[model samples]
Target: MDVVKPKNQRSKRALEKRAPKLIENPKTAMFVRGGHISQIVTDVMTDLCKLKRPNAVLYRKKNATRPFEDPTTIEFFSQKSDASLFMYGSHNKKRPHNIVFGRMFDHHLLDMIELGVEQYKPMSSFTSIKSSVGIKPCLIFSGDSFETEPNYAKLKNLLIDFFHGSDVERVDLSSLETVITFTVSDGKIFMRVYHIALKKSGTRTPRVELEEMGPSLDLVLRRTHIASSELFKLATRRPKALKPKKEKNISKDPFGSKLARIHMTRQDMKQLKTRRVKGLKRKRDTAQEEGEGTESSPKRQN
Candidate 1:
C-alpha cells in the first residue's frame, strides 16, 4: 500500500531534517587579554577583524594574569559584554608564543584550544597587496576523507564556525576561484590563501588561475571538543557512592599502630596514688626539719 503525506507535514519534516545555521546578525563581540601580542597572533587578529565587519566587531583589551586558568570569570565578563567569542595570547618560558581561541556556550566560556605557532609571516610583509577591503574572500575546506575521518569532520566544523559564513564550500576539481583553501593530507592541515583570476576560453567560460597571497601559517589542532549532550549529562550526574568507613575500637590506643591493650587492676591504681602522695609528704617533712635546725642555731649565735 502507498500513502501520500500532507504538504504541511512534508514541509515540517524537511525543516526538521535541515541543520540549524547560526547567523551573525549581531556582530560577534570578542575580548582580548592585555599582554604582548606576538606577530602571528596580531596577523590572526587582523584576519578576524577583516572577516568580521569593522562596525560590527567590538573588542577590548583586559589586563589578565593567566586568564585561561579561571574560565568562570572570563564567562562573567563575556556575558557582561554580550560577547560570544574571545581570544588571548601569552608567551613564557614554559609555554612560549601561543594563542588561545575560545567560544562561549550559553554565556559561559566553553571549549578553548591553545595553538603554538612555529613561524609566522605578516600581511604587511608582502609588497603587492591586491586583496582589497570589503571583498568577502571565499573560504574552502578540502579533504578527500573528511566524510569518513572524525578529526577531519570536527576540524571542518570548527573552521566553519570560526569563519562564520554560510557561503563557505568544500573544494573540488570544479572549485576554481576559491580564495583560501585548507587541505588536509598525511595528518597535516595546509592553509593556502590566493588571488584567483578567470581567463576566457575560445567558446567557454574563463578558466580559473590562482596567485599566492601573503601571511600564511600552519595550524595543529588538538582533539578536545566535548559533546554538548555529554557535558549536560556530566553536569546532572549523581554523586558517587561513599565507601563504608572502618570503626575505631576503644580498647586499642588510637595513637599506636597494632599495639596491644594493657589492662590495669584497682590495686595497681591505688599503689600509684599512694606512691605519689608519699613522695610529696617526704619532700615537705625534709624541708620543715631543716628550717627547725636553722632556727635553733641562730638563737645560740645571738
Candidate 2:
C-alpha cells in the first residue's frame, strides 16, 4: 500500500528540517569598540543592565578602528563568553554612532540588525537642566497597510522582543505598563510609545485613550542577515515515539455476524417496500441503516 500526503505537509516537513535551532539559554554579550564612544551606546547598556539579565558581559576595546571588521573576532569573544546574543558599537566619519544587534545559532552569526543614530545627546549635557523623564506605559501598532504587509508582522515581533528585553513574562497586559507601538505605512516602521489614559463623560464609563510619550526613535533598520526561523520550530519539535501505536481489531457490530443478502431477500414484500420507502425518504437515516445492516424482523429473535 502507498501512503499519500498533502502539499502543505510535505513543504512543512522540508522547512522544519532546514530550520536553525535557537539557543536555549540566551546569554547576551556586548563589545564597545573604537576611540570615540557615543552616549546612545552607554544608554542602551544602562537599559540592558536595568533589565537584570542573569548573564550579560560588556567588553571595551580602546583606540581601535572598525572593531567589527573581522568575523573571527566576534566568534572568538562569543565562544569565550558563551553568549548567544551580541551587540557591537563603533563610530566613524561615514556613519557616526553605529550599533549592530545580532544573534548566534550554533556559535555562528545568524542574523544582524544595524541602526545608526543621526543625532546625539549625552546624559551629562542634560544634567544642568532640572527636568525628569519617566518611562511610557503603553504601546500601539497601527496602519491600514499593515493588514496585508508581511514585514509589518516581523517589525511588530522585533519591537516586542526589543522592548520586553531578553526575559519575557506572560502576564496581564495591564501589568506591562511600558507599552511599545508600531505603525507601518509607505514601507516604513514607525514606533511610538504612549501612556494609557482615561477620560470621563457624563454618567458614562471613562473613554480609554493613549497619550504619546517622549524620547521617540525613528530607526532605519538595515537587515544584514536573516534570522533563522528553524530555532523556534526545533525547540518546539516533539520527540519521536519509541514504537508505532498497535492496531486493534474494531468489531463493526457488537452482536454477531451480519445476515447474508439471500436471507434478507426472504423478508415479506410489505416490509421490503417499507424499508425502500424509509431509505429513499431520509438520506442520513438510510445511510446509518445500510451501514449497520440492522435486522428487518419486527421482533429480534434471540
Candidate 3:
C-alpha cells in the first residue's frame, strides 16, 4: 500500500477524512466497468448506484483493468476517490456478466469477490413503489449457508459493508422502509430488494409487509479473497472510546434498562430492639403494671 503525502490544504483535508475516528464517515464506493460490458452489466451497475446514491462514483468511460492481475489501478482509484469500497463489472467471453465486489483497507485490497450474475432484473423492470434516495436500508442475510459456510460468511460481510449506508445511533421502524435480503442456497446467492409496507395494525405498531421493488439477482459465487484471521481482526479493530465499557455488577435488560447489583450486610433480627406491646409482654412485668394501675384508680375513686 502506497501512502500519499498531502501537499495542499485540500489534500490534507482528504487525508483527514480517511483517518480513523470514533464515528467514522460513511464509506464511498467507486463503480467501474471494463471496456467490454454487456447490457445486463450496465443495468446492474446503474441500479446499484441508484441504491447507493450520492456516496457512489460512476465512471462514464470504460477502463481496461483486471483486478486479479493488477490491482494497482483500483488501489490508486480507491485512494484518489477516498472510497473504501468498490464494484467492478466486466462481461467477457470466458466469464459473461461478471461483477467483482471488493473492500479496501488502508487504500489496499482487503477482499475481492467475483460473482457471476446469472439472472438479473433491474429496478426499472419493476414498476412498483421505490424507496427514496439516500434512505438507509435494512440488510438481512438469511439461509444456513451464510452462517455455516466460511465463503458465504465472508460474502455476507462484504455485502453488509457495501450497503450498510450511513452509521446511525438509533433505528426506528419508520426509517426501515427499504430492506435488502440476501439468501444463500445451493452455492448461489439470491439478492432481493423490497420496500416495506406498514399497514394498519389497529395499534401503534403497524403491520409490516415486504414488496419486492427490483434489482433482483441470482449470483453464483466465483473466486474470492477472504482476509486471514489476523488481518481481518486488525481491520475490524475499533477505537476504545466507541467500544462499550464493561461495568462490573451491572447489566442491561431487553428494554435497555440499567440493572445493578446492590450488596448489603446481613441484618440481625434480635438486635432491632423494637418496643413490645403490653399484651405480649412477660407475665411478671405485666402483673406489676396492672397492680400499679389498680392502686392509682382506687385512690382516685375514694
Candidate 4:
C-alpha cells in the first residue's frame, strides 16, 4: 500500500492511528464475508463483530478471497484498513461453513488458521440478556490439546489475540460481564460465549453466574498457514523500551517472577557489633585489700 500524504488534520490523525507503537493499542479486526458465505457463518461473523465493536470494522459487502490460494487479497484488505487481525467466513461443499482467523505483522500475513464449523447456534437463539459491546472478554481454554498439539496451541494464541481486547491497569469486577470459552476434545474445538449475571448474594461481592449468550460453535481443525519459529519470534518480539533491563543482582526465572541476590562480606562473630544486654556484659573484678582485717572495723558514730 502506498503511503498517502495527509491533506488535512483528520487525515494526519488517521495515519497516526495506524502507526506502530511501543505500547500497541488494542487489536482491531476486519470482518469479511466471502462470496459463498452461509447464513450460519454470517451470523457468527456478526456476533463476533458485536463483541469486537468500537475497535472493529465490518465490511457489509461480500468479498472474494481464498487465503490459501491468494493470500495477497486478504493482505491487501489488511493494509487498506490498517487492521492487524481479521475473520473471513465462507462455505463450500468440501469445507462447509468455513471461517478463517488470521493476524498480520508489519502489514504482512503472520498467521492464518481455518476451521470448519460443524454446528452453530446464533446469538438470537439465546435470551434477551447479552453483554455490552467492546467489553474485554475473559478467555478460558480447556483440554490438553491446546498445550500439547502445535497447531492447537497456535490457534489458541491467535484466538486470544483476536478477543483479549485492550490492556488496562485494573479491571472492575462489575465490568467483567463477558466470557469466551474454548474446549478441545476428540480433534474438535468447541467454542462458547457467556454473559456473567451478578445477583445479590447478601454480601459485598455479588454472586456470579453464567448465562449462555449465543454464537456457540463446534469446529474441526482444517488448513493452517503458520509462520516459521524465527519469523514468529521476530513478529512477537517486544520493544527494547518495554523489556525490563537486567539489574546487577536481580534476575527472573522461566515464570517471569523476579529473584534477587544480596552480597555481603564474611563477618567475625567476636568483632561484630550487636545489641548489648546487661546479662551478656563481662563482669569487672575489683582488687581485694592486701591484708585482711583481724577485727571488725569500729563503726564511726554519725
Cα TM-score per model: 0.54, 0.49, 0.80, 0.83
> Per-residue alpha-carbon lDDT of model 4 for 92-129, expressed as tens digits?
99899999999999888999999999998898898948
Candidate 4: the clashing residue pairs are: none
For model 1, the stretches where C-alpha displacement exceeds 4 angstroms are: 1-31, 34-36, 55-62, 65-67, 127-136, 143-152, 166-178, 185-188, 200-204, 222-227, 230-302
In angstroms, give how far residue 128 of model 2 lies from its true place: 19
CA lDDT scores, all candidates in order: 0.58, 0.53, 0.90, 0.89
Count of clashes, each model: 0, 8, 0, 0
Comparing 2 and 4 on TM-score, the stronger one:
4
Cα lDDT tens digits for candidate 2, 147-255: 5654445545444444344344455444443455666555555554444555676656756665544334455554455555886455336545534465444333567
User: How do the residues 86-113 of candidate 3 rate in per-residue lDDT, one tens digit apiece?
Assistant: 9999998899999999999989989889
Greater-TM-score candidate between 1 and 2:
1
Clash number for candidate 4: 0
107, model 4: CA deviation in Å? 1.0
Error at 244, model 4, angstroms: 1.1
